[model samples]
Target: MQQQPGLLFTLASFVAMIAVLVVVHEGGHYLAGRLFNTRIEAFGVGFGRELFGWTDKRCVRWRVNAIPLGGYVKFVGDMNEVSQIDPAIMALPERERRGLFAFLPLWQRAIIVAAGPLINFVFAILILAGFNLALGHPSSPPVVDKVVEGSAAAAAGLQPGDRILSVNGTSIARFEDIVTEVVTGVGKPVTLDIVRAGVPREVTVVPKMVETVDRFGNVTRHPQLGIVRPAEVIEDVGVADAFRLAVVDTGSIIATIGRTLRQVILGERSLAEMGGPVKTAQIAGQQASLGLVSAIAFMAFFSINLGFINLLPIPTLDGGHLLLYGIEAVRRQPLAEKVQQWAFMSGFAALMSLMAVLTWHDFGSVGLWARLSGLLG
Candidate 1:
């Protein structure tokens, strides 16, 4: 049995992941701003009280703060880390405003804001590409080696020696493809084209939702089809092929995320599956305990998620800024200050509420509430 990661280890892993991703994200914004000669007032890691910092030659204050949850980059003429405009900076002479972020051309500003998320995607792709180059590509044939008794696969008449050809009309190149389809189509009927004994046939299987408890007392639920695959095959690939595969993999993962979000919104998936900071830390810790390669892979996956999340068109996020810029581009004018402020406020509130709910769920998943109640009794 694998040893569970300790609390401290898990927390350290989580913090490290956040720190690296935050720097990469904010670094993208900072680099793009510099490319356009936009002045940066501060680049901070973490939030709240300052732990230590230094002023760069360009007068950018680089800071390490007390709270390690998140970080920010404050552009010139911004009132806060979220980059709200400072009216006082607007009053500065036009000459003084030349390098201010607010004064930059709309296109330049948009690029600066978008750089953060774009770089995250790039970062993930590079990581995956590197892995592929070093480890080669891994795949297993979509042949069923065994079918668990009383499982959905058994109910659907799937048997050993069956080869899956497609899932809902999507061609399955490998066993992983079948697993992905089943996982994503949890609790829904999945149509599979299969070949058995040199004969083609089809089956409809409804994956059952299953709950699991890890050694650390964390509960997780996911859908599963009780079919096992044979040994995997590893194929060597050139650098070009590796990179191409990485791009394809990254795009597929992004699309999967979009699909999952859509399912959640459409009530096809459970909100409880969504994880917050606590759950993320737990997962980070588990990955770290597995080994360096596992940890790095998790980091890459999280990087893609981070980038995708920021691109959401919620106010106060990078996507929100881009949305406003898009509107300004269409209207040839910025929205009213009041309107922008209200939107940001609403976004902030919505985010906080979501965080609260997810955190609660995370705590419950770990039996924290149960423990507390037991202690009280």
Candidate 2:
């Protein structure tokens, strides 16, 4: 098949992201199962035909499969003949009955299911903390990076080297402070004290309502001032600042995810705002092409996404399974088999439908259809 010049690179990145996330997610299940002494039949990375795998000490088959999208850990007896009311179990050999997933204690099963999502979140927090420790906290300094033409900053004669002193006479200590003031000051003229070209200057500008597009392609408006960070403003800080910045950034990302999800649920946002594998690959490829810093940043963002999605309370997801575990714990019994099957079917269908929509959007946004149509024409 003919390929786009850099298409393979993009696909590789997408695969890598999925593979790593799947391993981490499945590893959580494997660990939890081991802790509870549950029998693990197979732990496979990437679904489909097995490419290579080894037998672990516990006799579990550990292997990589041909598909790179994700992995799974099969628990013994998880869907055995006994649990499924299959007559096949009666005819099976005695050795096969020992470690079926249904035989495990309910508490153990719950823990095993919950661990996957928990690990994803833990991985995100760790990555955030590690990044902060390495790069230090990002300071919101009041410095101009860019002043686009016709923008509030440009209209106010703001220059790239300007250090903002105050916004509307309010003392600004950090860059984010200016943003906060600007967002709230939308449509209102605000005075800025700026130090530019080694001289203090004064400017006034109004924040404009700016349209913002999120990951899912939903658009919203917020106050914006077309000013960016100055290139020369890298203030050095101590370890304490780095740790603080990491925690703050992590919390901020999580809050943003929560808000985005809420918007989607409330119908304020559309599912198109969501990105599937195609978008991820394109983004990852773009980031990779940009160099190390950008790629690392993308990794951080992707990790947070991994954590967030896995926690959704949908059947076939870690969060959904955990929710079921909670119910089982309280009721002292498993949900009916029929109910579980239906729920899984519903969740799987929903996910597939979402994937199809996102994939179609991805192609359409990139003009793939137009390109193909042109060829036919």
Candidate 3:
């Protein structure tokens, strides 16, 4: 077996991953802002005190900050990195404020705000497409080789040789497709169209939540139907086809994320399963240890996740800005300054609270609390 990555290597991998993602995300905002001739004041990777930086010819301050958690692009006429409007900038004469972000047309502002998340999605798609072009697509026929006796598959009358046609009305061309569908539908009844003994039939199965423990004592729980498949087959894909498949795969991932979040909201999924920065770093390190390809794949997936999260309708996120812009478009006017401030403050608090909870969970997962107690005892 491959040796696990060391702590320092893990930390380095985590930082590298965050840094790359932040640069790409912030770069998106910077590019979009420049497109409309908006003046960018600063482009910094990470948050908090600046470690080192330099001003470019365009007068944009490029810097790397102390904290590696996230980054931002500070635009002219913005109060701070979050892009809040600066009253003084807004009050400037029209001609003097021409290139300021706050003075841009409403549509332009929306696009600039959205560019960050949109570019992340685009980048992920390109990475996946490249992988498909290089490695070809691997898949297996959606035929059940075996069904564990006590599994949901067997309970639903699934048998060896049954060919799955679709899951929950979505067509399934590969066994991997079935796995994706079933994994996300845990505890929920799934409708499957299948062919058994050359006869078309339908089956309903509810996947059981199963916990697996690895050799390192790490436990992971996922929903499973307990059906086995034959060896995977790799088929060469053309460039165009590779990109098309990549787009489809990206959409599927987004859908899965949405479904998982819905389950969490409905109390069907545990909060412990949700990972924060610490857990993410651990996973990043593990992926890095596997190989360059694995690490890159993780980056692509995480990029998609970063894009999706930022598009959420939370006040402090890109999505939140879009939400406000949407309301502005409908109202034909901007919201009052006090109201916007309150929204931003509330959103920041909500995000911080969520982060704290996830971080605590991360420490607990690694047995940090237990180790501390042991030391005290």
Candidate 4:
């Protein structure tokens, strides 16, 4: 049977990506809790009412909840009133609770909270590595695939068949090297050695400084030769090269995320440029149309971003808990309950406000609200 790929496929893919990320994130908490000897009551794959659940011999209740947004693990002695604290735990002699979470050392508490983000980081690296291995190493041969008419390349007498041999008196062995020279030489006259129809020719072209936005919303200025990159044949790498490529790719993704955040902070981009869950589903549909490989790549990109965002030191997030633990470690005691309550409330309010604004922007971008307004009118 043929699989009909449509909006449904996109919706399913979006949910699946979220589910995988939730498991990895929450599994870290569950595993760390067990390692720290904390009693875990329930490990749920989603929130709200349980679709199905079962208890293990070790007394760990695992469940699939109806809501597909995220998952959680309920721990013993947690502040949540819903979790049943064993009489044994309460009676464990106040001395025992003293060193465990209700009693454990501060360092242990920090580690437990930190594990979730750490797992996410590891997941991103592994996914990138898997993709690189499967897709093959990228090649950078020096060839001009397309020359924009009236652009620098065309103005410099560059044709579609020109093979770049050197740039700005520098020898070029890789296509990437050629690109680096051209981009970095922006606003400077670059001397190019090209083999056009087997004739070695030299031309001087002043690169134009152009501003472009990366996928993560980063705006960058670079020299533009206005030539399109030709498709290079991919070659599978050895085990070592494959691993190295994965690491490099992961670093690139992290850098992109950082640049985008900086741009957002600097007001180089608007929140209207950001996408919410609705836009993400649409993107998933677009990727699915391209093929499975593209869809998987999209998932990896979003997963990396999700992991990075959750690590921000804001209240109600894992990073926020880590921040609190750090303060506790320094102060030699927990902060007042009232202070914690205030912080959490403030954080919740901020998050809700941001989400509301972003959702409106999303609806505006897709013209959903416009359609509804038209209907009313």
Candidate 5:
């Protein structure tokens, strides 16, 4: 079935957003290839027939296409879009195939493949750093405000207006840190160094396990001390502080995502929590509606996710290629052609299945399915 022309606006927005990230990702491969002295035949910003483009002086076809969904970099002596090796490489003269990607050493190929995801992470960090500097990253100090009556905090002799100095000797920088400390120490006693009325004292409290549901109906269990964030006061820091906080923030995000993936793998979390491209597009559209800052924040978030996803050691991804290269390095030869072929097919199928499920899930999320059912009725 043909897609309606009315969806072009949404498609255009999605394409434009994805194109920027894809450029950053594919450009990493291009630069890495150049650094490794590999010959490039074509560098496409999108797949399929060329919409319009120009060949560089080095004879590389740098082009964009009608389909702005994704991009690729084709190297000399490659059979298809990805840098998968071609059988014809064997027929080439030694010196000729030497500059080809496949003929490059295993370590070099691994670097080239891994570069794309690595650069995406760097891009995400830079974007987050920019946001921190511009928005004045709210550094809310961990000052106790409202303590739930008869709760663990109250039972521990904690009172309102007490400033939490540290948790388990890890100095508290922000109110958010308190949550981190308490949640991690769930069901276990935690020492808090508090400053109250110009006098310092130590208090020990145990966080109670509590289950909460998010907007998506996902339930998460955390240790709660029944304390709320003090108040809204944005602490402006220096350039050094901005980058330091940015790195911390980015690392925290990566850790959280890693934990979530682990939970899914362990069957502790629902698979419905995982989202695909359509889900991403829906969220992106919502964020874009808020304003440019929101959109940029969303981009930074997706950039981090994109980097992490590509770095997974599943087939057809950068990590998968790196894994193959690692095997090749150990064995001193490439895997059999049949094995590589099977792996690629499996990876492709897995990727497509994930996309299909996510797209179906997204329709329900955006109310598109309800609207369609209404029309049918």
Candidate 6:
């Protein structure tokens, strides 16, 4: 929180990044509400005390709040940022009630609730598309272009031009997957299935842990099989191809997230591997310092994650709103107001608990606990 240059720069970059994504998210809701004829009372750029604001011609208050974390769109007859229907709104005139969010058609409400995540996905697609258009599409087949002398590849009989088929029985299609599996399974024996000279063979090897120092002198460790690609091959793609590949990239990302979550659920990953806002900010800052392209890539990944996470049918989130709509559709009636309130409360508690755990993990990652222990010792 102090004004150290590095910390300050990091906080600024994090706030700026969050502000961009949050505005995009809230703007999605606001625009959808407008399209659906729902009266949006306030469009806030941030949460917390309002620093300044202006009322638009349509009587919609646009506010910039003190907090730079995120933002929301407050619709008419809403009790809070989560868009809970105000109890008093029920007694309003029918004309007024019709304009309020509480009285909107279920279909329209669903569209408005869903628009936030929908636009996030759209943003990611467009960002990825832009990246592909500006920078050529990344294309690297699972072919070994180079083999280090006396390294794992050489020791395991991996020859140049060998096309990798799989790793430990998991088939790999992209060159990136080879690095991912090796990194994830570091210090473990792996069986690399390869096709050499049109003949299939298997090679056993253990990836060597390599220490890499970034420009900022940050040392990170990862497993390397000593096989390398001389240079990444990039192909220029047209608009249609870019868009199609963008969708494919998004799908791959979602699948990867699913696999990671499954691994965690199956106890293959430790809870300490998880992270929250602090980690996000730290990484965001680091990415920003790297370059604009790196930062944009990071934001795209985060935006997709945000969209995916919000679609889960947990209460107090956009997904939870959709869940309520689903229930109403099934029961042919709205849930009781008290029941909805309790559900929201339960959701809030769950989210806070998750945040607490993630924050604890962040502190540990930063060596806060270790530093404290040293002092107390």
Top candidate (TM-score): 3
Give the per-residue lDDT digits (tens) of candidate 1, residues 1-377.
46778999999999999999999999999999999988899999999999999998999999999999889999878999999998787678777888889989999999999999999999999999899989988989999999999999999899999999998998988998887777776577888899999999989988889887766556666788889988999888889998998888888788788888888899988777888999899899999998999999999999999999999999999999999999999999999998999999999999999999999989987679999999999
lDDT of 3 by residue, 36-149 (tens): 999999998989999999999999999999998899999977888898998777667767978988888999999999999999999999999999999998889999999998
TM-score per candidate: 0.94, 0.73, 0.97, 0.75, 0.81, 0.86
* lDDT of the candidates, in the order given: 0.91, 0.72, 0.91, 0.74, 0.80, 0.85
lDDT of 4 at 292: 77
lDDT by residue for model 5 over 1-377, one digit each (tens)?
A: 22222355456556777999999999999999999888999988888889899998899999898777778889988778866778867888776767888777778888899899888888888887787777778767799888998788988989989999998898888888777666644367889999999999999998787888644343557678888777777767668878888889887678667867886777766566677777677566656655678778888888888889889887788888888888988999989988987898898898889789877877776578999999999
* Tens digit of per-residue lDDT, candidate 4, span 100-173: 44556777777777787778877777766776678887766788888998798889878887888988777776
Candidate 2 lDDT tens digits, 1-377: 22232888777766776777788878998898888777778888887888988997889998788988777888765452112323345466767665555556766777777787678766666665666667654565678877888887777778887899998787877787676666533256788988987898888887777887644343446667788864333445556665566566666667667766786677766666667777678778777666667766777778777767877888877777777778888898878878988887788799889889999977766668899999999
Off by over 4 Å in 1: 195-200, 213-218
Worst 10 residues of 5 by lDDT: 1-10
Evaluate model 5: give its lDDT: 0.80
Candidate 4 off by > 4 Å: 1-5, 81-92, 95-102, 139-147, 151-225
For candidate 4, give the lDDT of residue 197: 91
Q: Identify the runs in model 6 with alpha carbons over 4 angstroms from their true place.
A: 1-5, 146-159, 165-173, 180-194, 200-226
Clashes of 3: 0
How far is 194's C-alpha from truth in model 5 (Å)? 8.6
User: In model 1, what are the clashing residue pairs, if there are any?
Assistant: none
lDDT of 3 at 333: 96
**Per-structure clash totals for the candidates:** 0, 16, 0, 7, 0, 0
Error of 6 at 11 (Å): 0.4
